[model samples]
Target: MKALDIRVMWFQRALHLWLLVWLLSALPAAEWLWEHPVSPELGDPGIVSGLLHGFGVWMPSGAAVPVAIALLLFAVIGAFKSRPWWIGALTWLFFCALTDRAWLANNGGTWLMRNALFWSIFLRVDPSKEHGPLSLVPIQVLRLQLLLAYAITGLQKLHGTTWTDGTALGIIASDPTYGPSLLPVTPGLCWAVLLFQLTFPLAVWWGPTRIVWLAAGVVFHLGTAFWLGIVDMAFAFLVFYLLWFPEEGVAWMMRSLRITSTANTT
Candidate 1:
């Protein structure tokens, strides 16, 4: 492939990588899905149950539900195979429950892993191909939800004069709700975060800029984990996006993981 062609491929994969980072959030989302069952009593419950029913899944709370792992495995395999595309899409819906949990409980749900898990499938779905009717419906729904999230947050982020002024990081760090640990270095950290949120989408482009920006992205997520105390919302949560960097990066990760797995087998 020509250099430009290779760049385009990696860029496309980087997009998927971003979504995959969001997909690993399945475990915590499954927990919330069990504890909080949505029904007609909650008002307009048809949407939730209807979607689940459409899939082969029934969501009643269970302590030992392997649903999360099942879905994760299913998505990984589907990324390899081509099962009902909607299956991957439905996985995102299940995690939406946890995002709701975060909003309802007022801590972005204390489990940002849902974002990783949902995006895992999000980045993988090939919309141009057919996956049958049920698959398409849920896929569309998932896309809408993702768009809404970004649009809403982007607007809210802009609404704050501090964010617009390029100091949103300070706000997040100083705010007890998000990143109190950075309160000491709020000014510098705030500038870094503001720039990150603003520039993240652009990192999808190619060249040295992408790598330097992506490495910065990892550091940025790590800072969030340290300063905000959000559970598992760190560089590790987002490493999947780096799969687009180079085959070597992905290979290194897989090889290391294999080594660790082999060691554990002893």
Candidate 2:
């Protein structure tokens, strides 16, 4: 096969593997909720570990992150844009962002902007290279991850008993584990959760409606953090969720990457 074909094959293989991972997660995600169970049972705690557990996604590429970065290095050395190296880098970045969320990485506004930067990065990608084509893979995959997370979160509310009535917020407001611990939310908070929960799935569809609800979502998650006064994790998830937006231009994104990339060119 030609080198380009080989690169395409590699990218396809990586995309397939990522999708398979996502597909396999459904049952396990639901089951894990029962087994590990991060409460609130609806809204994201906004932290990385809490968001990962609640979303049923395993982030924190862990030791795997460096390996992925190494692959990114090798891919760049050899110029293998078609090889899903970008996908690997994104997965790693997602994990790294998750870590930031877990520890309350920065001061209040600082973390918000920090995560927003990551969110913007998530939307951007570089696909122009002679060695390999920049498929729309990254943008699509990032959105898929966000949509999947929203679906699962919505599922939690739909399936849970506490969510059906107003009591879910009340129950969590009392629990601290399910909701924020710093300051408890009011029964009024449940209404906010309910509105967002009802609209979450709709936020994924393509259109102006998506942005509207998505903005509402940011407001909603931020509200949860502020009201409950637990900001970090919640903000990270929202920042991560912003990965769904459209990329302005792949060429610019990649050129920017070239300037910023730490790896050496072969």
> Best lDDT goes to which candidate?
1
Encode model 2's per-residue lDDT on 129-168: one tens digit a residue: 4332334344455445555556677677778776666677
Index of the highest-TM-score prediction: 1
Position 10, candidate 2: lDDT: 38
TM-score against truth, every candidate:
0.51, 0.43
Q: Supply every candidate's count of residue pairs whose N, Cα or C atoms clash at under 3 angstroms.
A: 18, 5
